[model samples]
Target: MALSKFLGLFLIHIALLSSSCFAADPFVFYDFEVSYITASPLGVPQQVIAINNKFPGPTINSTTNNNVVINVRNKLDESLLLHWSGIQQRRSSWQDGLPGTNCPIPPKWNWTYQFQVKDQIGSFFYFPSLHFQRAAGGFGGFIINNRDIIPIPFGSPDGDITILIGDWYTRNHTALRKALDAGKDLGMPDGVLINGKGPYQYNDTLVPDGIDYETIDVHPGKTYRLRVHNVGISTSLNFRIQSHNLLLAETEGSYTVQQNYTSLDIHVGQSYSFLLTTDQNASSDYYIVASARFVNESQWKRVTGVAILRYSNSKGKAAGPLPDPPQDEYDKTFSMNQARSIRWNVSASGARPNPQGSFRYGSINVTEIFVLKNKPPVTIDGKRRTTLSGISFVNPATPIRLADQFKVKGVYKLDFPSRPLTGPPKMETSVINGTFRGFMEVILQNNDTKVQTYHLSGYAFFVVGMDYGEWSENSRGTYNKWDGIARSTTQVYPGAWTAILISLDNVGVWNLRTENLDSWYLGQETYIRVVNPEVTNKTELPMPDNVLYCGALSKRQKYAKKSRFYVNGYLRKMAVKTNNG
Candidate 1:
């Protein structure tokens, strides 16, 4: 009997240990400090805001469903908020770093962000979301690896590479914000950058000396997974490798049909994964170039950010001559054709591809439709603002999510229009509310003459269709009813409209705004509230205990009386007093 009992206890101990090993999840912690550092991207010295004194901040590598905790200490004079781009903070929207949903950490204060990267696997990034701070740096990549249970669609590459492409400005971020605040338009960029360095040429012959170029090293006859992200504040970039082909694999978190292309157009707030084989001549290096595309046709020139793809065995003092890329930056036909070719890979492993809640969106019933039309700039309350559907959004005196949770009144309105209004632009708060678990569609119509890119927080959407002119009932026939790709950010061409379908599976306040920093800062944005249903916790979650309140909410909380109150058998008086007083 003694021996039997000892054996039983040993088995139980072994079982517990096995379970713990299988269920272990990593917790990533980062200490981020926002400060100024001198760097030269265009060979001209300038002060840029950096995190931990490193420009293009540190990359946070994590696995799916892992918890990420970042302690941010603000050292700048301005308020700072960091947004995890393309991260669907599922059932944890309070962790999303948006000004309308969370309070910023003031100078010298520390704020901690704790959330799980649930059910997501892809190449994403993080950047500052306030006061045009992104242009001055403090951005980094957030890469999430897939779970062991899931199989990747493509073959495993020998290595992985990340390239961040963007346009650079010589002026300080504050000066640019001041110019925009004064209603002056920010013209073209001084130069473009690839991984924070590039060549800048003033006039035709005056080129900056001692320019550092970003270099990529690879072995001959080896394949690599290249994760490319367009993190620019403005302008669309076309990435290409001279004399080489690219096999596209994924976008954001969705597996896409592998297609071959020589060049790819990546708009702001977008990311893509491609398989690049270093099958070229190993004796010589090649040029990898990224240039501005779809800008003003008359002003289109050879403004490009270049890097060298050097072989590991090659020895060379110079990388020979630069290879030529397509000079037609204004080719609308080519651009649109490339955009239409991106489709979800139905045959990929673990891909649902169903008619509802999957790649094929045929049987999915869109419960609501939001028609957002972009109008020209207009002066409102002595400031030039960009209007979305005739309303230029104004920040409330408190965070919308906090106000909703505490039942604060007059913080925002729930009756935002579903269609654009005709007439003069007006300064107003635009917010649309939807029932939890309701599938919705948003149609973005660009009425102006420039390309527009928009990003949605807390969720990724299926890009169903895009077409020229205004969207109407007749436009439904042109929609990509099947095989629409899922992405967090998408672009709408000039005089065209883009349609995206999303499910309100996450209950919280979300922001839908332009990726263009100028337009976003000038009020081309709005919020959406997902109301929780009483039955299920799948779409709704409990409020985090450590959330910070600011603005008017802070004042009310400070002056409110705290007394004993009980309704649900727990102490609810603190929340009641702060919300009601």
Candidate 2:
């Protein structure tokens, strides 16, 4: 079968002139109804969340600078929030989708999110943020195309395809959450799925009926751009195509220097685009493989997910043995070396006219330095919890953004530490106070046994450096300041440290957390709270008109909300002039 298609981009252009017309960028909108449905992605029947009755939600096809408005109607019994994984909610934090920053849409209620894709291009994704919902369903590809004026660095491919590969569990999300709540560990996944499908003939002997795998129909001697996203909840995946090399092109909306490899390590919450040329024999199909990386094979079943790459005129299926994966080495140096090889194509234009590295990040002085650390989960007061810098994140009873906007005190503390603390972990609603427009250096120290992937919302930071052993002042000497690829999510291997340089130009409270869903739920997360003392309409948008005020602010405040307006297809923020309820 052909690749599951994306929602067609409807360009609603209005001509300004009669003869030689000028058309503005159009707004892309979708009314999404999130509800539950019975599906068997793992060959076991379970209820999964669906958007508009589609299991994997809907792929969003949009362009840079285009305003995207999604009206999400929640029909699940539990609350729901959807985060645009790599989309920087620049100047508009009200729609960031973190439960602490924005309120969740209650059951049977709906909320509309409006934000500009602004100066971004390439692969990304959106998924449900509340609870372990993502383990069951609710994820889709988000592609931002470059405008006509911008030039693509590589030759145009025959077509673009998106693949969502991840580990799967037979237990439903609710059962998984209950297990975690009871201080239990979720063992290995039952299977791995590609594009919301189970393995080929995985349960044919065990069960009479089972879900099948994905098949990508391709033409001989033609090339295609495949955008891959590791939407898995936990496991880190290494993806490969049999008898083919994956030409790395762009990652998480940034163009990278072209490099070819047989296998690629994709951590949870990561996205990439690779150019695959169909150069092999056309008589038989090929296997598309995604296997769990850093997983022990002796004690547990090998997590191998497979799909098919078929030629249009093919006669039979694949017959050869699967490609050999890299040996499971305790010291994962080969993957690290491969990651280090990916660099930014500094000369290529992204969504804007300027080159990728037009801003000389090395020349800029860092205003602040932070050394955050993570440790393995420990049983605290009869519950397993993960800590970031000695603090277990506690979600506040109200939205922190609404509290900060109304100057409500005591909603959250801004005393989050810049370094790990000395004693046992503590739970608090805490955040890091970041100076607006400050170029900062952040080092994430991973002392945990497993590889950790961290994701920063509202901004894509530069991965400057990473190394085994502990990080120190001397580690700065090994930094890659010249051409660090900019991306939202990065992996720091076990017992390793990764440093990033981020300029806090966006104003708002943003989530900085590990991508592991269990850890995030158990509190391996924090927020960077950036305050612009001289906030303006140009610098920040006003509070969303539909914001559900709670906590301290709900006690007294009510106001005629000054909202935004879509002026001729562009989003324009209105000034706040009233405050009283």
Best by lDDT: 2
lDDT tens per residue, model 2, 1-581: 12332111112112111111113545676767899999887667889889989878889888988877677778999989999999987777888888889877778766667778878898999999998899989998999988888899998899999999998898999999999999888989887889988766432343235467789999999989999999988899989998999999999878999999999999999999999999988778888988888878654344678788999988898765667777647656888887888888777886631224435677889999989999999767767899998899989878788887777788899999988899888888989999988988999999999989999998888888899999999999999978888899999988999999888888888999999888888999999998888957666777755565556655432452222122211211111111111
Worst 10 residues of 2 by lDDT: 572-581
Q: lDDT, candidate 2, residue 80?
A: 92
- For every model shown, what is its TM-score relative to the native structure? 0.88, 0.90
Tell me how far the alpha carbon of residue 13 in candidate 2 is from the true structure, in angstroms, after superposition.
Answer: 17
Q: What is the lDDT of residue 142 in candidate 2?
A: 93
Which has the greatest TM-score? 2
Query: Roughly what TM-score does model 2 have, to 2 decimal places?
Result: 0.90
- Backbone clashes (count) for model 1: 0
- Where does model 1 exceed 4 Å of error? 1-24, 200-206, 296-302, 317-323, 327-331, 350-360, 535-538, 556-581
* Local accuracy of candidate 1 as per-residue lDDT tens digits, 205-255: 434567877889899899999999888877888898877898999888788
